[model samples]
Target: MDNFLQVLLDGVLNGLVYALVAAGLSLIWGVMDVINFAHGEFLMVGMYVSYWLGFILKIDPLFSWVAAGLFLFILGAVTYKIIIRNSLGKSGMAPLLATFGLSMVLKNFCMNRFTPNFRLLSGTILEGKTLSFGGAIISVPQLVTALFALVVLSLLYWMLKKTRLGWAIQATAMDKEAAELMGIKTENIFLLVFGIGGACVGITGGLMTSYLAVYPEVGGLFSLIAFVVVALGGFGSIPGALLAALLIGLVESFSGFYIAAVVKYVAVFAVYLAVILLRPRGLFGW
Candidate 1:
C-alpha cells in the first residue's frame, strides 16, 4: 500500500509536466486548427536555453524560465507568420508536411550544433531531497515541478476564462469565419495562440531539463506522447488534457512497476488506442 501510494504521487507529479506540454499542443490545435509538429522543438529550444543560462551565465534554472518562454514565443510567432500562415486554407496536409519538415530541420540543426550526446545540468536544489510519508518517498524536484504546473495551469485557466484575448482566441477557435465577421483579426489571433502555445511548451522544457537528460532526439519522444494526450483528451479541451495526462502518468508508473519496463509504453499506447477506438471524438472533443 505504501509503495502504491508512492507510485501514485510520483505519477501525478510526472503527469503535470506532460499536461503542460499537451496543453500547449491542444491550445494551438484548438485555436489555429494547425497541428504543430514543431511544437516539441520549441520545448527543445527551451531546454537548451535553460542549459546555457545555468551553465554559462550561472543563473538559476527557475529564474531563466521567463527568458526561455519569451524567446520561444517570438520564435513561434515568426514561424506562424512565415510558414503556417502561408499554408492556411490549403489542404490539411500542407501545414502538416511543412511542420513535419520544419521539425526535422530543427532536430538536425540541434544535432549539428549540440551533437547527439545526452547532456544534463546538475543542480543542488532538488538533489538528495525527499519527503517521506508512511514509508513512501517522494523527490523534492517532483514536488516543485508539480506545484509549478499547478500555478501555470491556474494562470492559463484564468487567462482563457477572464481575459479579452482569451475570448478572442476562443471565438476564433469556435468559428474563424464568424470571428472575422465580428472584427476579430484571425491572423493575429493565430499568431498569439501559436506564441502562447510555444511559451507553454518552453516552460515544460525548462522544468524537464532539470530532471531529464538533453539530446537532439529528446523532443521527438515527448512530442509523440503529447499527440496521444491531445487525442485522448480531445483536441482542444484543457480540462481533458489535465485529466488524461494524469491518467497516462499513473498508467506508465504502475505498468513500469508491475509490468516489464520495456513494455510500459506499450501499455500506454494500448490504452490510447482503446480510447480512440471507443470514443473517436475523444473525451471532450466535438
Candidate 2:
C-alpha cells in the first residue's frame, strides 16, 4: 500500500508535466489544425536555454522559465511568418511535412552544437531536496513542477473562457473565413496561437530541467507521448488533455511498477488504441 501510494504520487506529478506539454499541442492543433511535429524540439530548445542560463549565469531554471517562454514565443512567431504561413490553405500534408522538416533541422542542429551527450543541470535550489507525506517521499522539484503546471493550466483555461483574446482565438478556430470577415485578422490569431503553443512547451521544458536530463534526442519520446495525450484527450479540448495526461501518467506508473518498465509505454499505447477504437473523435473531441 505504501508503495502504491508513492507510485500514485509520482504518476500525478508526471501527469501534470505531461498535461502542460500536451496543452500547447492541443491549442495549436485545435486552432490551426497543425500537428506541430517540431513541438518536442521546441521543448528541447527550451531545456537548453534553461541549462545554459544556469550553467553560465548561475540562474535557476525556476527563474529562467519566463525567458525561455519568451524566446520560444519569438521562435514560434518567426516560424509562422517564415514557413507555416505560406503553407496555410494548401494540402493538409504541407504543414505536417513542414513541421517534420523543422523537427529534423532542430534535432540535427542541437546534435551538431551540443553533441548527443546528456547534460543535467546542477546546484539548483531544488537539488537534493525531498518532501515526505505519509508513506510517499516526493522530490521537491517534481512538486514544484506539478504546482506550476496547475497554475499555468488554470490560467490558460481562464484565458480561453474569459478573455477577449481567447474569444478571438476561438472564433478563428471555428471558422477562419468567417473570423476574417468579422475583422478578427485570423492570420494574426494564428501567429499568436503558435507562439502561445511554443511558450507552453518552453515553460514546461524549463520547469522539467531541474529533474530531467537534456540531450539533443530527448524530445522524441516527449513529443510522441504528447501526441498520444492530445489525441486521447480530444483535439482542441484543454480539460480533455488534462484528463488524458493524468490517465497516461497513472498507467505508466502502475505498469512500470507491476508489469515492467520496458513495457510501460506499450501499455500506454494499448490504452490509447483501445480508446481511439471506441471513440474516433477522442474523449472530448467534437
Candidate 3:
C-alpha cells in the first residue's frame, strides 16, 4: 500500500509538470490553429536561460524563471512577427513546415552553442530536500514545481474565463474574419497568444531545472509527450490538458513500476491510440 501511494504521488507530480508544459502548446494550437513544431525548442531555450542566470549570477531558479519566461515571451513574439506571420493563411503545409524548420534551427543552434553535454543545476533553494508523508518520500523541488504549476494553470483558467482579453482571444480563434470585423486585432491577438504560450513552456523549463538535466536534445521526448497530451485533452482545452496529463503520468508511472521502465512509454502511446480511436474528436476537442 505504501509503495502504491508513493507511485501515485510521483505520477501526480509528474503529471502536473507535464500539464504546464503542454498548456502553451494547447493554447497556440487552439487559438492560431498553428502547430508549433518549435515549441519544444522554446522550452530548451528557457532552460538554458535559467541555467545561465543561475551559473553566472548565483540566482536561484525561483527567481530566474521569471527572466526565462520574459525572454521566451519576446522570442515567441518575434518568431510570430517574422516567421509565422508570413505563413498565415497560406495554402499547403507552409505553417507546419515553417515551425518545423524553426525547430531544426533552434535545436542545431543549441547543439553548436551549448554542446551536447548535459548540465545539472545544484545548490538551488530546493535542492537536496525532501518531505516525508507516512511511508512516501517526495522531493521538495518536485513538490514546489507541482504546486506552482497548479497555481499557474488556475490563473490561466481565470484569465480566459473572466477577462475581456480572453473573450477577444476566443473570438479570434473561432473566426478570424468575424473577429476582425468586430474591431478585434486578430494579428495582435495571435502575437499575444504565441507569447503567452512561450511563457508557459518557459516557466515550466525553469521550474524543471531544479530537478532535471538540461541538454540540446532534452526537449525531444517531452515535445512528443506534450503533443500527445494536447491531442488527448482536446486542442484548446486547459481542463482537457490537465486531465490527459494526469492520465499519461499515471500510466507511465504504474507501467514503469509493474512492467518495464523501457516499455512505460509504449503503454502511454497505447492508451493514447485507444482513446483517439474511440473518440476521434478527442476527449474535449470540438
Candidate 4:
C-alpha cells in the first residue's frame, strides 16, 4: 500500500509535466489541423537552449526558461513561414511528412553538435531537497514541476477562453473562412498557435532540466507521451490533455514499480491501444 501510494503520487506530479508538454501539440492540432511530428524536436531544442544558457552564461535553467520559450516561439513561427506554410491545406500527409523531415534535421543537428551525450544541470535550487510522508519520499523538484505545470496550464486556459486573441483563435478554429470573413486573420492565428505550442514545450523543457537528463532524443520520449495524452484527452482539448496526462502518469508510475521498468512503457502503450480500440476519437474527444 505504501509503495502504491508513493508511485501514485509521483505519477500525478509527472503527469502534470506531461500535460504541459502536450498542451502546445493539442493547440496546434486543434487550430491548424497539423500533427506536427517535429514538435518533439522543438522540445529538444528548448532543452539544449536551457542547458547551454546555464553552461555558458551562468544562468540557471529556471531563470532562462523564458529565453528558451522566446527562442522556440520565434523558431516555430519562422518554421511556419519557411516550411510549414507551403504544406497547408494540401494532402493530409503533407504536414505530417514536413514535420517529420524537420524532426530529422533537428535530431541529426543535435546529435552531431552534442554527440548524443546525456547532459545534466547541476546546482539548481531545487536539486536535492525531499519530503517524506511515512516511508514515501517526494522530491522538491517534482513538486515544483507540478506546481509550475498547473500555473502555466491555468494561464493558457484563461488566455484561450477569456482573451480577445483567444476568441479569435476559437473563431478561426471553428471555421477558418468564416473567421477570415470576420477579420480574424487566421494565418496569423495559425502562426501564433504554432509559436505558442513551441513556447509551452520550451518552458516544459526548462522545468525538466532541473533534474532530468538532456539529450537529443529526450524530446522523443515526451513527444510520444504527449501524443498519447492528446489522443486520450481529445485532440486540441487542454483540459482533456491534463486529465489524460495524470492518468498516464499514474499508470506509468504504478506499472514501472509493480511490473518492470523495461516494460513500463508497454503498459503506457497498452493504455493507448485500449483507448484506440474502445474510443477512437479519444476518451474525451467531445
Candidate 5:
C-alpha cells in the first residue's frame, strides 16, 4: 500500500511535466488553428540553448530558462513570419505540411551542427538530490520540475483570464476576422501567440535538461506524447491540456510501475481513448 501511494505521488509529479511540454502545442493549436508539427523542434532548439549555455557560460539549466524562453520566442516569431504566416488562411494541410518540413529542416540542421551524440548536463542545483518516504524514493529534480510546471500553468491561466493581451488572444481565437473588425491587430496577435507558445516549450526544454539527455532526436520522443496530450485535453483548451497532461503522466507512471515499462505509453493512450469516448470535448475544453 505504501508502494502504491509512492507510485501515485510520482505519477502526479511527472504528469505536470507533460502539461508543460504540451502547453505550447495546445496554445499554438488554439490560437492559430494550425497543427504545428515543428513544435518539437522549438523544444530541441531550447535544449540546445541551455546545453550550450551550460557548456560555455557556466549557467545551470534552471537559471537559464528565461534565456531559453526568449530565444525560442524570437525563433517562433521568425518562423511565423517566414513560414506559418504565409501558410495561414489556406487549406489546413498548408501549415501542417509547412511545419512538418520545417521540423525536418531544424532536425537535420541540428544533426549537422551538434552531431547525434547524447549530451547530459551535470552539476545543476537539483543534481544528486532525493527524498525517501517509507519505501519510496523521490527525486528532487523531478519534484522541482513539476512545481515549475505548475507555475507555468498558473501564469498562463492568469494571462488568458486577467489581461488585455489575453482578451486580444481570446478574441482573435474566437474569430480572427471579427477581431480585426474590432480594431485588434490579427497579425500581431498571431505573432504574440506563436512567440508565447514557443517560450512555453522552450522553458520546458531548458528545465528538462536537469534530468534528461540532449540529443538531436530527443524532441521527437516527446513530440507524439505532446500531441496526444493536446488531443486528450481538447483542441485549443489550455486548462484542458494541462489536466490531460497530468492525467497521462499519472497513467504512464502507474502503468510503468505496476504493468510493463514497455506498455506504459500504451496504457496512457488507452485512457485517452476511454476519456475521449466519454467526453468528446475533453475535461475542461469548454
Candidate 6:
C-alpha cells in the first residue's frame, strides 16, 4: 500500500508536468487550428535557455525559467507572424509540411549547436532536499515544479474565465469567422495564443530540465507525448487536456512500477486508444 501510494503521488507529479505541456499544445490547436510540430522544439529551446542561464550566467534555475519563457514567447510570436500567418488559410498540407520542415530545421540546428549529448543543469537550489509524507518521499524540485504548475494552471484558468483577451481567445476558438465578424482581430489573437502556448512550453521545458536530461531529441519525445495528450483530452479542449494529462501521468507511474519500464508509454498509448474507441470526441470534448 505504501508503495502504491508513493507511485500514485509520483504519477500525479509527473502528470502535472505532462498537463502543462499538453495545455500549450491544446491552446495552439484550439486557437489557431494549426498543429505545431515544433512544439517540443520550443520546449528544447526553453531547456537550453535555462541551461545557459543557470550554467554560464550563474543565475538560479527558477529565475532562468522566467527568462526562458519570455524568450520563447517572443520566439513563438515571431514564428506565428512570419511563418504560421502565411499558412493560415492553407491548412491542408502546407502548414503541416512547413511545420514539419521547421521541426527538422530546429532538430538539426540543436544537433549542430548542442549536439545529441545529454546535458544537466546543476545548482544548489535543487540539490539534496526531500519531503517525506508518511511513506512517500518527494523531492524539493518536484514539489516546486508541481506547485508552479498548479499556480500557473490556476492563473491560466482565471485568465480564460475572467479576462477580456481570454474571451477573445475563446470566441476565436469557437468560431473564427464569427469572431472576425464581431471585430476580433483573429490574426493577432492567433499570434497571442501561439505566444502564450509557447510560453507554457518554455516554462515546462525549464522545469523539466531540473529533473530530466537535456538533449537535442528531447523535444521530439515530448512532442509525441503532447500529441497523444491533446488527442486523448480532445483537440482544443483545455479542461480535457488537463484531465487527460493526469490520467496519463498516473498510468505511466504505476505501470512503470508494476509492469516493465519500457512498457509505460505503451500503457499510455493503450489508454489513449481505449478512450478514443469509447468516446471518439474525447472525455471532455464538446
Over 1-286, each residue of candidate 2 has an lDDT whose tens digit, in order, gives 8899999998999898999999999999999999899999999999999998988998899899988898899989998998899987799899999999999999999999999999999899999899988878999998998898888888998999899999999999899889989989888999998999999999999878898999998889899999999999999899999999999999999999989999999999999999999998999899
lDDT of 5 by residue, 46-157 (tens): 9999888998898998788889999999988998999999998788699999999999999999999999999898898888899887877888888888888899989998
- Quality of model 1 by C-alpha lDDT: 0.84
Number of clashing residue pairs in every model? 0, 0, 0, 0, 0, 0
lDDT of 6 by residue, 183-283 (tens): 99988898899899989888888877776778888887778888888988888777788888889999999999999889999999999999999999888
- How well is each residue in 101-171 modelled by candidate 3, as lDDT tens digits? 99999999999999999999889999999999889999999999888889888988888889999999999
RMSD of each: 1.3, 0.8, 0.9, 1.3, 1.3, 1.2
Q: In model 3, where is the ten-residue run with the lowest total lDDT?
A: 87-96
What ranges in model 4 sit over 4 Å off? none
| Rank ordering of all candidates by lDDT, starting from the highest | 2, 3, 4, 5, 6, 1
* Candidate 2 local lDDT, residue 222: 90
Per-residue lDDT value at 123 in model 5: 90
lDDT of 4 by residue, 31-105 (tens): 888898988899889989988988888788768888989998998898888878999878889989999999999
lDDT of each: 0.84, 0.92, 0.91, 0.89, 0.88, 0.85
Candidate 5 residue runs with Cα over 4 Å from true position: none
- Candidate 5 is scored at a TM of 0.96
Q: Write the per-residue lDDT of candidate 1 for residues 1-286, one digit (tens) a residue.
A: 9878988887888888888988889999877778999988888988888778877886656677788888888888888999998898889789988888888998899999999989888864665579997888988766776788778877887888899988988999999899999999988999988888888888778767667778888888788888989999998788888888888898988898878778879988999999999998788888
Clashing pairs in 6: none
TM-score of 2: 0.98
The candidate, 2 or 5, that scores higher on TM-score is 2
Pick out the ten consecutive residues of candidate 6 with the lowest summed lDDT: 120-129
